[model samples]
Target: MQADIYKENGFFLDEWQLLEDEQALPTEPGRFLVSLERFVAAPEAFASLPEIAILVRAGDDVTVLAPHLDRFTMVAIEFAAFSDGRGYSSARLLRQRLCYHGELRAVGDVLLDQIPLMRRCGFDAFKVVHEPTRRALETGHLAEVPLYLQPAARPDEQPAGARAWARSPAGLAR
Candidate 1:
């Protein structure tokens, strides 16, 4: 429960608890986050629980979740490592192709430098354990260039009467 993001997102502390694989479901009957494997193992059990979130790992085909998208109230994509970029694609697919409207969260190894890009990829919340990243988020001192050159899930536009280097992702799409 360490995501420091927009105050309105209500991620200051994780309201949903992440339930790892093989872990027993809590008896308190609260919102829980479970991996896709656990959900698939016994979909019925998870379905009975209200407000369950699904965690999608890297390299997993997001399309597989299309059928069950409605069952999930939230989707957490694991980064595992900062160098791995597969999570970005997962977020995009969930948002663009699958038309998932649930809460999208970035978890595991989340870094400050990647927050903006993650946001563009449709991640609105983050579970960052990195100290530096947490500090940066708390201080609202993100070192972002604010000039993306590639098209992303979240559209961006070029500023009128601005330098070419300032071109946004929307401009490149055309």
Candidate 2:
């Protein structure tokens, strides 16, 4: 699992493994990933475990984590399907709106092409189960357009023509 998890520093083991169902909590004693509903229901149940954070699924209200942001070490947004872009908005809200400063992770159905967009949206870590993505990330072989047309949490320079919407990578005068 370590090699599959990608971060800015490099791949690392998922210290707090993700749990799909709350019913499976009994088997996982220490730190683990919990659902939005389960964690919001009774956060005190896991008050002692700092590593136990919530995994918000697509369409789930991320505002619920606002009050409990201080208690979490990480927040993982699930992308059940790669085509579902709901997780991207969720990540944006967590970072830009709520101002969460913890480790924001992108989990489930993460692909090679989505990594750059994910980082721009404020995802610091990614759970890449796709082999091609892992290989590309491990080899530093990625194809991404450094220019952007929309604003994001990660700051970018002006692309060209002074167009407010367009942005180029930092240090590159476009």
Candidate 3:
């Protein structure tokens, strides 16, 4: 695999402007994406790309696209800067309220510190801009733990899956 970035929450800087020129897009037409400007400035563009992916900024006019999300394959949210956490909330809404199952990627300012929280809010992949050193990335790996956890061990969070599992015999054995 050529390392597709739908796995990270960062922007693929090399591919940022790939769609600026309409003709540059793949003629086969499988996935399409729109920048925040295009979606906000011209809603018609959404209709033009039938099954495309889109990129949106947190502050952009996202409400306009709410009704048209089903037409998209994925909606990649741009962080622009790491300090901006608005994208996280947007991702949460897309998954929880909108019921968006398509790919959701986090691009731009993808810092190492944000992956865990990003996944919680519904981001599946990232185009991590600041690729961490081998040691730093490896440190976060918990071999003893399962691939996933419920409730996140946060004070106010709860996991329905974990709760249900705890009621089962298998859960009781653990």
Candidate 4:
């Protein structure tokens, strides 16, 4: 069974059902998250499906998918590997540039250490397969520092310090 982790009231909780690889697309009406490739290849097929979501890989071009953002209830960005940081950029683009308001999820290679950064980048849900990471999330001991030096896509984030540039018209520090 695949377990999905999501944050609720400042704590992580498991509450999601990931569609299996071999399962056929549900035409009978239901919620399902399809791979980015599948969705891109045949968008018309899934366009009318109820509660559709898409899983974005590291190399996928988010810009191309911008037009379809409103069609999905959620967007899952795959980390693939901890060293690969493209997912972070993708999340930022989706939230900041595209203005996606639905749930943004982080999946694969989701370590506890990366959760804080992922959240800052606009990931509200995380699919943590690692046991240690799961434990850390459950215990609420992810060792995350609330302070961030840079401004992120989320409006809720506060600058690390008060600076003239930080409060400038652009709202970004030099």
Best by lDDT: 2
Compose the digit string of candidate 2's lDDT tens values, residues 4-73.
7788777888878666663645443577888898888887777656477789999999998888888788
In the predicted model 2, the residue pairs found to clash are 2-13
lDDT of 1 by residue, 1-174 (tens): 344433323437677777878788777778898888777768888756878989889887778788889988889899988899999999999999999998898988888788888887888888777888777667777766567666767545544335454466876776
The whole-model C-alpha lDDT of candidate 4 against the native structure comes to 0.79
lDDT, candidate 4, 1-174, per-residue tens: 445565644435433345655677776666687888887777897766768888888899888888788898889899889999999999999999999999998989998889888888989988778988877767777677667777777676676553646567786734
The lDDT values for all models are 0.79, 0.82, 0.64, 0.79
Query: What is the Å distance of residue 56 in model 3 from its true position?
Result: 1.0
TM-score of every model versus the real structure: 0.80, 0.83, 0.63, 0.81
Error of 1 at 39 (Å): 1.3
Better of 1 and 3 by lDDT: 1
| Superposed Cα RMSD, model 2 | 5.4
Which is superior by TM-score, 1 or 2?
2
Steric clash pairs (candidate 1)? none
Off by over 4 Å in 1: 1-11, 156-174
Q: After best superposition, candidate 2 residue 166: deviation in angstroms? A: 12
TM-score of 1: 0.80
- Please, what's the RMSD in Å of model 3? 7.8
Error of 1 at 67 (Å): 1.5
Residue 49: error of model 1 in Å?
A: 0.2
